[model samples]
Target: MKEKIKKNKERGIITMEKQRLRKNKGITLIALVITIIVLLILAGVSIAMLTGNNGILSQAQNAKKRTDIASEKEAVSLAYTTAYAKNNGEGKVTYSQMQDALDDNGTNAEASGNIIVYFPDSERYYTVKDGVVEGPFEEKPETELSAVEMFENGQNCDKQDGTCTNETHLHIGDYVNYEEPTSGEPCVIGPSQTGVENYQVYSLENNDLNWRVLGIEEENGEKRLKLVADSPVKRTGVRETEEGETITEGVGPYFDIYGAEGYLYAPDAMDAISQIFKNDDAYEARSMNINDINQALGKTTDEQIKEKNFLTMQGFIQYKESYGPFEGQWTPEDWLKQNRPTSIVSGEVSAYAYLIDNGSLPSELSGIATTVENERLRSMLFDNVEPETGKAYWLASRGVYALSGDSYASFGSGVVTSEDGITVAGVGDYAFNSNGYEFGRSGYAAVRPVVILNSDVLIEKIEDQPDSWQ
Candidate 1:
């Protein structure tokens, strides 16, 4: 019986050892399979990234190529336009002509393919090969000649007879105006204000005239006409105070010279003016105020100016003034008044007093008008003023002051102005003062050197929001 028990124990031990070995082998196999699967996934990802057309690397390359092409095309177009202008409305230029001009202007002019130049007026396009001008071919249907047009053989109509044998006369684009009578109207021909300034008149015989037309003129040309039909007169006012002295006071002869129409939002304009003061480097001016504001006229103001915490309008008025019988130009009376108030309570009175005093007031207030006639002042205010006839002005607050709800302390709301002082427009967003505790929310981000008024009240105003008071 002892021998049988010992044999049974030995068998049990051997079986247990075999089972442990089998379990270890199964785990090893499973782990190897998992590792192989992970490796396969990584390989697939790598292949796709390397070969895919829209991969990250390919997209970046394509974007760079597109930008390079656009820049090259612009450079080529500018070169052509400059060459055309230099030649006085005569002589057709081929691509070689343009390429030589560009090279002279320090630009690369190596022709990559067959270079063609199109003239819209003659409807002629000339090709350049081996530095020689070739056939003036008819424009291809698929080719877009936006800046000019080209015609070959003048097949559409007879140039000498001024008549179209085919439907060319009736089918010609809307370039002809039958309403503009040729008699006594003095065929007002030259440059069509916007584009190429070549205009020639052909007497339409038998209802046909082969007039070559070029599209609109180039926008930024040095030799473009600067003729203005009418300009608005800027006026100044002289009011005698109780102390007895002639003082220039009152609003404007606000003119819409550049066809500036619609309501002028005083507060919004003031905010823009403030930004002009803050970014004198961008505007190439010194400060904010009417003068600096004027220098930046015709250009869009900075987007940061709209943050109503920086500027506002004070009042609207009809301004009128005269210098002398010989020198005074008739002035308009409607003016949108503005003020940067230390406090809303006394801001209006202070601004009015400053304007009325005209540099004769106490030292505190006299700083406002010391440099009214300076070149910097005129450049800042008069040069860039874009006032429409029927626009509104707004009142804004500056410095450390608390504003009402939805009203920003720095730049306030815009309001409408009629002939009479009427607040027709609603207050702008964030167009109120901010509380003192919220200085961080109300103050400007940086100190900008700005002209605060027409006088010498130019100073650096702090623009930042603080977390807590000292």
Candidate 2:
């Protein structure tokens, strides 16, 4: 009996021990699962922090870049300030001076002509002119625009709907506005019938729509903009005499009395140009000259004109050599200084031929060819004419022409006139009572003003019906 009791006790102990082992194993499994879940959560958070957008790594890198750029800009500013101070408050700083200033600021830079380049980046540079710093230079466009292109694109035309009728591109023959001159008032010499006192009058009412682009001219080794008026500032014409005969008035008799020499340097031409501006050194306004006409027509050549039958086309063969300073001849070195005639009565056939070829000639003024359809061309060529009156416009030029095929030389004033509803580009003159014989050329004209702009002149665009340029 004792032995059986002992065996039962041992079996019970074994069963209890097995239950304890099972409970401990379950607790260990639960603990293992919780540890694995916590590890996975931690790993996911670490990846997001390191590799996702706006991660710590990215933020750190961005911070570094920003710091570097700021440092660079600060260095540039410091260098510029130092250089400017060294320049005695002058706006300009030399390339060498800028380099020295940069060195002082602990920034290495190189000098290239008027440009100073940052040693670290070639794209960064600054332009300097005569010891003046123009400021930081950005990378220029791969295709730099030409001067003509700037004029075309920078025009002040409204493009709200992307359609512009009035030329968006400001070019030759386009109207440009400017401030009226406050001083050096221009004298308008009217017809003799208006009296000499009235001839010296100045009216500001006639200046509207007067300014137009003449074309480009070379001044001081740089291309400059030239502006001309649509009509003359003065009126010069013939007055009926007591005997019912017409005679040239205003500066016409000067051509007869003083000859071509005096007319070339006549006060009418010189004073008219000078009095339009306020005597500003930056602006040079003058009377339109023959050379201006020639230049606008692409400086045509004699061969080209002959090939096109310009003289035959215009029925001006007899007066072929009536205009002076033909193509490839002497041009005035200093128009303001030249006191003598630079050219004799020679033919500039190219100008007329170009008009015919381009169909720029007026239907009534030009020969049996197409009329000028382009408004710009019309403004350029015939805008100065008072076609109804057959009055010509004076040019700052002079010539000598024959009087009715006579041996006696007669003086002529350069003019762009209309005769019998035809355009006449030649000289003007008046009848002289020389040796009691009435023998001289007769013409009536006025003065058209021109302005040569300074190289640095700014063309401002206005929003009015006729845009202004200053």
Candidate 3:
């Protein structure tokens, strides 16, 4: 309602007015929004309680707890029954003798809450812990098992209850090749089946194996280990020597404990590896072959680099000082006549001396001969056995003589036969009578190829062992 006042005359009647003020009521828009949000929050909390990871409804639907307990109980009953049956229906049955019967293979049934009762006589039992099925954790495995049981002699890994034993590192003196156990066949337990491919190679650094490639040169008409594809470690090849003898030689997991080389050689990739076999290089230390060549010292500063330039991953190498090639092992004229040994780098000792001092002695000669004569480094260098492959593997030391001729200046000094006969069977009597060489080339042999990892090559083991060289 409004009250109005009327004017008496034209001047006073112009301004009579009515004014009213109303009370604001009900909830504001903001308050209404807040109420709706509160309701949604409560609804979500209730829903989550009904269906989240630990919700009562979720647990009820799992069905695992019930089924696991039942399965486990059944396994236990089976073990008990089997043990009782063995008692011949007459003697008192005890679970003690059933230990082996209920080991990992018998007890794991993907169950839970079912308790295990290991009879005192039971030496082994299975257990399902942390959702993993494991058993026979109680005792050591018997060693008398057959090769098949041990994942050998063509046993499939999936066929065994236990996994194929993971392959371990092969040590120096192992003579394994792809076709060792039987000719043209992969060894029973080498690169063929074992997943372990790369082997650690080294030289006697600080009396331990240090890394060095003998020298880039052709042997058996094949290249040495290189960064290119088809690693020598995986190749199935035969070592044909100068004396017309063929022997077991091919690329397989080899260890050069002195060189710090690692190979990722495996059976499947044997024929198709990525690393190329360029040639052998024997210098312990040298300037990059890319540098100038030194004739007097027989340094292949230029030629050696061109040959080893195939290096890929290990390219992180830097320049080092030149050392060795004491001299006159092979004549420079000999290399020129045959047309090879384009690059000659030297080492601290002749290949012969290195073999005598560092090579792993053959099992037969371990106690009999401490050092084979220099000329006999080839004939006397015997193969070592690889327990896994059950065969002898070749060493990098090819049975060749280091030429000793003071006459050819630097090239002849310490030159070893590149491919055959410890002496020059082809080069005439001038090789043995005048040159003083030994051993007719007899056979091909496995080479423990090596490469030095850059000092920066980071590895977990290297980091863990700070005193590694020590």
Error of 1 at 294 (Å): 57
**Clash numbers, per candidate:** 70, 6, 63
Candidate 1: where are CA atoms >4 Å away? Answer: 1-42, 77-99, 103-152, 155-163, 167-470
Rank ordering of all candidates by lDDT, starting from the highest: 2, 1, 3
Once fitted onto the true fold, the runs of candidate 2 whose alpha carbons sit more than 4 angstroms away are 1-132, 140-149, 152-168, 185-209, 235-262, 267-275, 278-283, 304-373, 387-391, 403-405, 428-443, 461-470
> Against the correct fold, how does model 3 do in TM-score?
0.21
- Report the number of backbone clashes for model 2: 6
Give the better candidate number (1 or 2) by lDDT.
2
lDDT of 2 by residue, 68-152 (tens): 6566656666776787798677434434556678888778666432334454563555544433444344653222333333354
What is each predicted model's overall lDDT from 0 to 1? Answer: 0.29, 0.48, 0.27
Candidate 1 lDDT, 359-407, residue by residue in tens:
2345553333223333322222222222234222222322112222222
Error of 3 at 381 (Å): 1.8
Q: How many clashes show up in model 3? A: 63
C-alpha root-mean-square deviation, candidate 3:
24.0
Comparing 1 and 2 on TM-score, the stronger one: 2
**Clash pairs (backbone) in predicted model 2:** 92-131, 92-132, 93-131, 93-132, 94-131, 177-469
Q: Mind giving the per-residue lDDT tens digits that candidate 3 earns over 366-431? A: 332223222212221222222223112222221112233322211111111222111111001111
